[model samples]
Target: MIYYFSGTGNSLHVARQFADRLCEQLSPIVNPVLTHDKSIGLVFPVYSWGIPSVVDNFIRRFFQSAEVRSETPPAYVYALMTCGDDVGYADRVLDNALLSASGRKFDAVFSVQMPNTYVCLPGFDVDSDELCKAKLNRVQARVSEIAELVAARRKDVRRLKRGIFPFAKTYVVRPLFNRFLVTDKYFHVDASKCVSCGRCRKSCPVGNILLIPTTGGQGAEVKEVPKWMSHCSGCLACYHSCPHHAINFGNMTAAKGQYSIMKQLHG
Candidate 1:
């Protein structure tokens, strides 16, 4: 089984592609507690130098709730992550989470580059169209190459920007972003552009939104209001799929680039 936690479409897209190619069953991370099917592989994006709370909780509850079965094969754990910049810190976060889960063991871990979406920094710029296209092409090629290795069950170490930098990312960079940037002003919803549509709520892999009934100009009305679950995976599907462009990442995230909801390329 392939379990994926994605915020936008990048990780989900990659997870779907890998599962399709491998002929494996794909499961969304929203249902954290599922019956144990040892044929498991995990794919997600790194956020805040840690596994998104969504993925962390899923692993915790899923493994704990699972019932061992004869048909259930031994879990051969594989992890794939997509990142905006250096990847070392995220790997450490993942390693710690897996260790916390007790029984799960990682056979391999891989990383891939997606556009750096953390635009909350003081001076951030989205890639130019030409540069973006070039990077996309590179990602495509890298994903394909990594897929072949997964299909063949190769065991190789894969990382980016060495190890030390990524280690500092979560501790230094990510913490600052989370404290003053992400939580403060990054995730926002634009009411003016919204048409009272609840599409974002439905598309959310984690069911984070809560639709509420309110009296509007037309009288009694029901609207999808975002009441974010703290366990957000940072997929950004809510931001992208907003038909009215109602979702905003606030001041801190206004200039941040869009993140790919795809998975990583394992070595």
Candidate 2:
């Protein structure tokens, strides 16, 4: 069985590819399900040079559940992490999380470069059309190779792309990012530009957005705008999926480009 957590479709697309190649069933990490499969695979996006909180929490819960702890044969655990550029010791971080929760680390870990979607800070934005195309073009072959290795039950595989200064990025910057930038409070929607569409709410994988109807023009126009809740996956899906680009993360995303993997693939 393969468990996955995707925000804007990158991880989901990659998970689907692996599931097709390996003939495994895919389940969202947020959903609760019990399985005794010998091979357990996890696919998720790397966030803030580490695992997203939602994914982390799910991993803990999934392993500690009464149904999962009593399994007989050990599972061949592995992980596939998708990142914009690099993962920076994220595999180690995930291994540690799994070790702490279930007393066993991932036997194999892989990282794949996906299109850039993080744009909440200065000097960081979505990739250009050429770069996005280049990344997408390579994902299939990479995922295929990974699936072949995984199908062979390859152990001790650590194929990953950890860019320079990995320790600093994972240990130092990740903590700060989790503390400061992972909240939904910074999300802003331009009421004037909003078309009263529910796409923002739909874009959120965790259902952390709400649309409230209010009188806009002389109490005649009831416009529905997005309001964020406390629980956020920090995926920036709301910012990327808005048709009119009305959503912004604080003020940093005002000029950033919006890249959607589904739109890039299908449209």
**Model 2 shows how many backbone clashes?**
0
TM-score result, candidate 1: 0.76
Q: What are the per-residue Cα lDDT tens digits for candidate 2 across 101-162? A: 88888889999999988998888989988888899999999999999899988999999999
TM-scores of the models, in the order given:
0.76, 0.97
Candidate 1 root-mean-square deviation in Å: 5.1
Worst 10 residues of 1 by lDDT: 258-267
